[model samples]
Target: MTEQVYACIDGSVSTRTVCDYAAWASQRLSTSLTLLHVLDKESYPVAADYSGNIGLGSQEQLLKQLAALDEERAKLAIQHGLHMLEAARERVKSDGVANAGCMQRHGDLVDCIVEQQGDMRVLVMGKQGAGETHPGRQVGTHLESVIRTLHRPILVSTGTFKAPERVLFAFDGSQTSRKGIERLVSSPLLTGLQIDILLVGADTVEHKEQVKWAANTLTAAGFNVPNTAIRAGEVDEVIQHYCQQEKMDLLVMGAYGHSRIRQFLVGSTTTSMITKSTIPLLILR
Candidate 1:
């Protein structure tokens, strides 16, 4: 399958940010961009039961009217989606991405993403969706589900996009972190950017060695490694502090456990970072 950067736009306030970030990633990876809009199935119900409520003729007429209304709403939604995609395409083109593709699918967001994962090199989405207005938790309803189901790297836009110059990788000497480092080395997404490694654990020799190995790998892969720090504190607190103190633009980390039970028992760092961080995140799987 052809590899392309997929930017999911839902007409939210963050749609423009998602487009900008997607364009940046596509340019860095030297790939084409596709602006995707999914019309959620639950947003428009198909049928309503009116059996035994009215006379047979009236019920039939009411059902027809309701069905017609639903169809009309669906058509309007499709038109809105197409307009959104076109606007997104133009936005990316203005950002130096010419001839970007546009796609519109009708289904659950996660299902649509899973179906289209074969051609996805990277997925870009906003931290919140269209319906999520309350600021209780800063994650979209479908974002977690998509992250668990899709295997590609996800670049989540937390706010307006700025060209990333300094990136911070939250590494913990685990197999997932090692794999994330290897993937970073192989991919051109973060090439020529200054990377700082942060490990939130004991300041022991083993932890220091882990940080060194990550730094060495990145440096060998032509990435500029400026600093590597092993600090002792809460995992989320330390990482958040480091990101703010060092003025890092992007946070790169490996996706945590896929098991729901594991996540329930021990909260996931990946999810926590996604929820609290103000900067964008690149989650590698």
Candidate 2:
């Protein structure tokens, strides 16, 4: 089971950006790249049930026609997925990752990811999927679910692609945040980049200590952590303003571990960052 960077390409507006980030990660990690396209059941549902007694013979005919239509639709979907994979492969290859693999699966996106995660080092995907039409601030329906389901790191790409020279690590004094820092240090993806450790909350002793620890860990691991700050403000607001002011290209943080009710009450910092941040996000779990 070789580790590979999996890039989910669904022919969305962000597909190219996803490919770019995935290629960047693959090159940085010195791993193979796999372009994955999942034919989700929700995207291509089965034919509707025409079982209502509108006359058995007519109903049977209608059912058969609908089934045939469904079959055709399935074929088209498969072809489209293959094309997407091929295009993604070409893009990644042009980005200096040669011999990239391609995969197409039929099932839920999360289920496919689970099945394929054994070989996955990291997953790069679009923040907005193909089904998203409204465009602004709307994330893909599967973005949160996929992030929650997979234990691996996920790089959510938005806007266009840059080399990510500067990264912002949104750190806190939690176990999860510490684990995120550990994982980030273990990987070579952000090795040569400048990362700023940020603790957005009270500027208390604990927060300051956490920021110090994160900076020290990164520094010990040979990372160029230029700045560490402990700000007193809302999590999302501080991170957003910091990213904009600092011109950070990538934002790294731990996945939100709160329950649904708690998230509803206080709002999810993870979702808020994903939705609001103009830069790409690297979420660790």
Candidate 3:
């Protein structure tokens, strides 16, 4: 089975951007694009909670009415989901993706992705979804869980879509970082693109050696590679500043290296980077 690029949609403002990014990726990788819309059962409106002293007949009639209303709402949600999928499919096709398709699933987004993981080459999704109340503040509720569950490359779309010409890889000398570098070197994703390997807050000889080793590996693989070490303030701030200053097209990094307990107590660099990044982020696990 040929691997396909999957784009998860939620009918948000970011959904269009996700579709655009997926189209760009599908075109670049020479793969089919699948636009997925999962109607989360939990998000559906439930009957109102009634807790008043009322007659038995009245309560039963009210319950029947609420049940009917809930059924109607569910049907409308399905119709809306199908409509979103169709619009996304047309948008991708209009963007010049030849093999574009869409699927409307009835379950949680993470569950749907897990079930379809075997055929997925890469997953593309927005940082925030439709129901996000805060304007520019929190990451999507499902983003972290999806990242934790899937061991594949997830491209988290930020602002808009632009074909990446220069890419930045955040290296911290961890095993996850090494795996990310290995995947980039082995895949055609970054071939012929200018790549910079950045090591932040570590100006020591050991850190420089690690950065040099990574650069050499990529260089041997025929990529235009450069290595830089910054003894800067904070790792996430430094990386974000460098990307902004240099106008980097894409940011690549490993996700969640610390143990679950440590990550919960100290927070995660991966999560911080994703929340702070302005360009698209390719997260490897």
Q: Which numbered prediction scores highest in TM-score against the true structure?
A: 1
Q: What lDDT tens digits, residue by residue, belong to model 3 across residues 170-195?
A: 88776657777889988777789999
**Candidate 1, clashing residue pairs?**
none
- State the local distance difference test value for candidate 1: 0.84
Of candidate 1, the 10-residue stretch with the lowest lDDT total is 258-267
Assess each prediction's global lDDT (C-alpha) against the native.
Answer: 0.84, 0.84, 0.80
Candidate 2 regions off by >4 Å?
Answer: 46-55, 256-269
Q: Residue 71 of candidate 1: its Cα lDDT?
A: 78
What ordering of candidates by TM-score runs from best to worst?
A: 1, 2, 3
Q: lDDT tens digits, residues 20-84, model 1?
A: 99999999999999999999889855444555555766468877777678778888889988999
Question: What's the lDDT of the predicted structure labeled candidate 3?
Answer: 0.80
Cand. 2 TM to true fold: 0.91
Q: Scored by Cα lDDT, where does model 2 land?
A: 0.84
Q: Give per-model TM-scores.
A: 0.92, 0.91, 0.88
Per-candidate RMSD vs. true structure? 2.9, 2.9, 3.5
The better candidate by TM-score, 1 or 2, is 1
